[model samples]
Target: MPKVKRKTKAKSKGGIFSRFRDYISQYMTAAAAGVTVVAIGLAALFWAGGYFGLLGEQVSRMTNAGAVAMGMDVRRVTAKGLDNTQRNDILDAVGPVIGSSIFHFDPHAARARVENLGWVRVAAVSRLWPNSVHVSIRERRPAAVWQMSGTLHLIDENGVVIAEEISDAEYTNLPLIVGAGAPATANEILRALRKEPALWGAATALVRVGDRRWNMRLQKGGDVKFPETDISNAVRDLARLHDAYGILDRELEYVDLRDPENLIYREAGADETIAG
Candidate 1:
């Protein structure tokens, strides 16, 4: 039986071509994974080195050059409603515009920057097609001269400070507001005084008392103590008294209108007396 043992070929796992194909498939997969890792590492390196930003800038420059060649670049800038806002300031806020692509200009951002200026109440920025950019702004109106800590500032009607260190002569027509928290309450008294042209014209300064009420200093060396409530009526009554008896025209020290039922005043040298 040992002598009769027959030789037989071992069962084949696969054909030679199949084995070669498997080797190539494994090799390709490893190579692909290595390539992916290398690509990610290079991307991180480029980002860390700011190369991505430079590349983006270069691409932008090229795009801008192409746009310029197409005659879509900004060549001029025009602004309206400038008033107190400097033209150079607007140009600076709008960023680089000449020879830049008009389509790349951000109008909303430019408008926001322009509106941040002290005098600009509102602003609009637009790209004029083909070659121009336009900016329009409305300036804040100077309502009063707010004096704080010996420095003068221009304020708008809404009590917003417009500009600081302003010259007194330049804004002499504006009513002067003195003391702390005067700017916040100036509008109401200013409106009330405006109703009486004589009083408004004679007012030199409006001083805030305890952040609650106002004491009006007159140009003729007199003061009017205003009530915390009923400011409009108090101003009207004072104006009426002035019209009838020329009380404000007199050489008076102060007029106390704090009491709604009684009007009291004092001459420069006399004691205080109740008005009839």
Candidate 2:
């Protein structure tokens, strides 16, 4: 017998593989567009950065702005740690930084330039921001004008030679030191002389005899021999002898106070000033 044929349903041609391929195509296109946009953004950023001076040679401009902002003008610098003359000298040293951007100026170079000056023992410099620089200084205090190898040494309390600008008349009050280690010798000499300001004030020059001995010449004329040991005692005795003999008058040629007990003296003709 003929039976009614049931309609069979057919499956769709597009499966999971086709759906995956379509999704992959859309994703690839979107990724490509995204990558292109990112590349363009980076290129524009770099170009703008270069044009607006965000890179290379911007330091020079920064330096100039810094100088102007910090009040590094020639006139303003006078009120700082340096005098007008010293300021001019500093400007000359930092000439390159005068109109430079603060970022461009080499701080180390500037410091080195200023430190090379005569009186600058310790120097410091820093930026005040906006438009100013602050400078601080520690100057060397002269202990005495030292004389070494016949050359004058204007030294400090630490025995460092600060300057060679010797003026015989200007520094007449400072003592002269001779022989080896004159700088160190000057220290010892000043120490011994403090006990007797009358003698210390009268001293015109102090000569170091050998590396181990000390001799002081009076302002008027005469030598004071200080013993290697008990130098303080020798100085006290010398002061007493000066009081006794009136050594300041320049009558006696030399006095040997190295022998504290037996003070010795010699006239201009006798020659010998100290024993041993």
Candidate 3:
């Protein structure tokens, strides 16, 4: 009988990956050491370049390039809560980082620029991850027009100056205040006047006198003088008198409420006095 021919087994040729795994396992520690040495050398080179200031120009370019490649650049800028602040001004404040990296942007610096604008009262700048910048601004509201030293300035309720050299035609309807310290004390007088809608509506302006007291100008052509102390009580009394007797509706030149206990009124172009 002929013996059966035995089939020879084919020699196995491991793939490239299998060979690579074997190589890495055998020299794993040595490979790690080599990588560490290369990293140290690169770090040293960067430090030397920075110490000599040779890396400043290249560093920014490289950072920007890398950031762009990594999709970390600013792709959009948005402004919120803008009323009188022009859109161009807000864009100018954020112009520096329009296409730059959000990582390199300074939010504080941007916020300061926005707040320096004429209408911005409070501003906040922020970076959205990967590619967006957001700026929120609170614009100053014109509460009154303050006249001092022959100039008019727009002021907010908190006594802060919003704009100077404002035109009367633009803000003709707002309450007008005159005097050196009028802006600072304007809110108090305005608040007191709000208690009496009829009186407040009939009035036009409030002038600070000697930085101590106030003089209110009526729409119908008269002046109302208020005392330095107990102003609220004085205002209450005036409101009561006006409501009960229609005192303000009369043709009066001036009403002196400086003395809360006494109601003094003088007619227009009249020497006689009317008291209540």
Alpha-carbon lDDT, every model: 0.90, 0.68, 0.86
Tens digit of per-residue lDDT, candidate 2, span 89-153: 66665554444444445656667877777666766766554334455656777778877655776
- Which ten residues in a row are the worst by lDDT in model 3? 48-57
Order of quality (lDDT): 1, 3, 2
Q: Give candidate 2's whole-model lDDT.
A: 0.68
Model 1 ranges off by over 4 Å: 1-40
- Compare candidates 2 and 3 on lDDT and give the better one: 3
Candidate maximizing lDDT = 1
Query: For every model shown, what is its TM-score relative to the native structure?
Result: 0.80, 0.62, 0.75
Worst 10 residues of 2 by lDDT: 76-85
Clashes of each: 0, 11, 0
Q: How do these models rank on TM-score, best leading?
A: 1, 3, 2
The positional error of residue 101 in candidate 2, measured at the CA in angstroms, is 1.2
Identify the leading candidate in terms of TM-score: 1
Per-residue lDDT tens digits for candidate 3, residues 57-167, read 678889988998899999888999987888889989877786787788888988998898878999999998989999999898888889888888898898888887988
Cand. 1 Cα-lDDT: 0.90
Indicate whether candidate 1 or candidate 3 has the larger TM-score. 1
Q: Cα-based RMSD of the predictions, in order?
A: 4.7, 8.3, 11.5
